[model samples]
Target: MDFEIREDRTAQGRVKLSREREAYSRLMQQGYTNAQACRVVGIDSRTGRKWRNGRSADRRQKAAPPINAVVPPSGPSRYLTEDERLHIADRLREKATIRAIAAELGRSPSTISREVRR
Candidate 1:
C-alpha cells in the first residue's frame, strides 16, 4: 500500500509536523473523533486513528501516548460566579438583552445565552 506524505504548513509558510500532531492530540482530548480531528489538522483519518490506537506505520502494536499531550484541568471552573448568575437573573428580569448582560459581566453574548438556557 502506498501512503501519502502530507505536510502541514503554518500561516508563515513554515512546515511543522510536530505542531500538527499536537493539534490533533488536543482535539482528541477535547472529545473530537479521529476523523474530525484529522480534518482539522489536515491529515488523513487513518493517520489519526493509528495514533489513537497506538500503532506504528507497519500496523504493529506500539502503545504510546501522543507527543506533547496536555493534561486536562481538574479544578473549579473560572467562568461565571454565583454573583454573576444572580446579576444575570436580575438583568433578565429587567428585560435586558443578552449582549447587554454579557457586556456588563465582561463575557460573551453566547455565554449569557447559554446561562439563561440552563
Candidate 2:
C-alpha cells in the first residue's frame, strides 16, 4: 500500500516494487499461501494475486495478452511480394497518391512511399 501503483503499469519497469515481488516469489516457492506472502511483503492481497498470476477481467483467469495492431516486421509474410511491387510500379506510373496506392494494396502509405523511393 505504501508503494504507489499506477494503473498504467505497462512496461513501466517496477524497480520500486521489484524487491517486494522478489520476496513474494521467494515466499511462494517456500509454500506460503498468497495471503500470507502479501501480508509479509506489505502489499494488498489483490496486488499479490496480480504479482503471482497477473490481472484479468475475470478474476479466475490470467489477463488476456494485448492484441498487436500491426504484423511483426521479421516474418516473410510481412514483406511486399513481387506482384505487390509490380502493382506499386504501375500505380506510381499512373500518378496515384501514396495513400490511394496503399489503400488499394492494403498496406500503409509508408510502405507505398518506401516502394516508390526504391
Candidate 3:
C-alpha cells in the first residue's frame, strides 16, 4: 500500500508547529496534560496532543524569573495622612516644591504631586 502526504501551503503551518512544541514541553515540566498546557500557552488541543505524543520538533519552555529573587518596590507610606495633606498644601502655597514636600514628609515626589493635585 502507498500513502500520499499532503503539505501545508500556509504561513500558519510552521507557527502552529512551533507553538505545539513549546506547549508540550511546558506541559511536561509543569505536570499538565496537553489540553491544559495548550490553554496556558495559547495553542489548539489537537496540535498539543500531537506534540505531547512526541511529534514535537523542539522541547523547551521559557524559564520564569526566580520568584524569591525578585525584589518588589517598597510602596508608598501611609504616613501622609489627611492632616499631612492640609499641612503640605499650606507649605506648597508658601512656595514649597513637590520634591521639597516629599523630602520633608518622607514620601515620593509623585505622592506629594498627587496630594496637591487632589
Candidate 4:
C-alpha cells in the first residue's frame, strides 16, 4: 500500500493540520483540556475532540499517554516534614485542635486537617 502524505493547511494558511495536532497533543500533555488546547493550537473544538477520541480523519495513531505516566518535576515537596508529622501526632494525642496545631506549626488549618486525614 502506497501512502502519499499531503500537508493540510489551516484557515490562516500559516499552520498545517499536522502542526496543530502536535501542538494540541503537547498542550494536553501539559494539563490543558481538549477545548483549551485546541484554542491554543488555533484548531476547532470538534477537531480536538476527534484527536482526543482517536478519530482523526488522517488515520494516524496519535494517542496521548496517561497523565500519571508522565514523570513529575523532581523537587522538594512543599508539604509537612517528618518532624511536622510527629509534632502533629503528639498534638493529636494531647487532644489539640486543628487550628491550634496549625498555629503551633505556622501552617494553615486546612493543611493540618489534610495531613491528619492522610
Candidate 5:
C-alpha cells in the first residue's frame, strides 16, 4: 500500500516528518508493532525507535545526586525519644527480652541492649 505523507514538504525536500511521527504514534496506540508502524509511515525503523524511545539531550541530566547531599532527617535517629525511653522502661518492668522490644521498635537488638546498659 502506497501511503503518501500529506504534510507539505515545503522545507526544500527535507520533510518535517511530524505527520509520519503522529501516524506512527496512532498506529502504536491501535496495537500495531514498531516495525509495522515504521513500514506503514515510510520512515526508517531507527526513526521510529528514536521517536518511541527519545534521546536524552544532556548527559549531565542523568547523573546521580552528590554523595554528601544533606537530606534532612525524616524520623527519629541518633537519639531515642522520650516515648522510646518510656517503652523501654515499661518493657524492662515486664522483664521483656532486649531483642523483643528492639524488634517491636524496628531497632537492632544491640542498640536496645546498649540503651538498657546505659
Candidate 6:
C-alpha cells in the first residue's frame, strides 16, 4: 500500500496542528482545562477536545510554563526617601527579618531585601 501526501492540504503556511496538540497536552498537564488551553492556543474547544481524546495527532507539549502561572514583572521599585531608607535600616538593625520589614511596608520580602542590600 502507498500513501500520497496532499501538498495543497499541508499546514506549512499556518501553525501546525501537531504543534497545537502538543501545546494543548502540556497545558492540560499544567492544570489548564481543555477550554482554557484552546483559548490560549487559539483553537476551538471541540478541536481541543478531539486532540485530547487522541482522535487527532497534534501532540506538541507546551514548550514553556503557562503564562498565567508565571510571575509578572513587578516593575521598578518606588524610590525610597532618605528617611524611609533610614527607617528600613533601623528596623534591620533591630534584627527585623526580611519578612517582617516587607510586612511592615506592605511589599514583598524580595523588595525589602533589595532595598536594604542597596
TM-scores for the candidates: 0.39, 0.37, 0.34, 0.36, 0.39, 0.34
- For all candidates, the clash counts are 0, 0, 0, 0, 0, 5
Better of 2 and 3 by TM-score: 2
Per-residue accuracy of model 5 over 33-114 as CA lDDT, tens digit each: 9899988887778767767776555755443221132347865598888899899999999999998999888788888888
Give every collision pair in model 4.
none
Ranking by lDDT: 1, 5, 2, 4, 6, 3
- How far off is residue 30 in model 2, in Å? 0.2
Residue lDDT tens for model 6, 31-53: 89988888777677976665566
Q: What are the lDDT figures for the candidates, one per model?
A: 0.74, 0.73, 0.62, 0.71, 0.73, 0.66
Candidate 1, residue 80: lDDT? 82
Using TM-score as the yardstick, the better of models 3 and 4 is 4
Error of 2 at 42 (Å): 0.5
- Model 1 off-target regions past 4 Å? 1-16, 56-118
Q: What TM value does model 5 have?
A: 0.39
Q: Clashing residue pairs in candidate 2, if any?
A: none
TM-score winner, 3 or 5 = 5
- Give the C-alpha miss distance for residue 35 in model 2, angstroms: 0.5
Q: For model 3, name the residue pairs that clash.
A: none
Which runs in model 5 stand beyond 4 Å of their true positions?
Answer: 1-70, 74-76
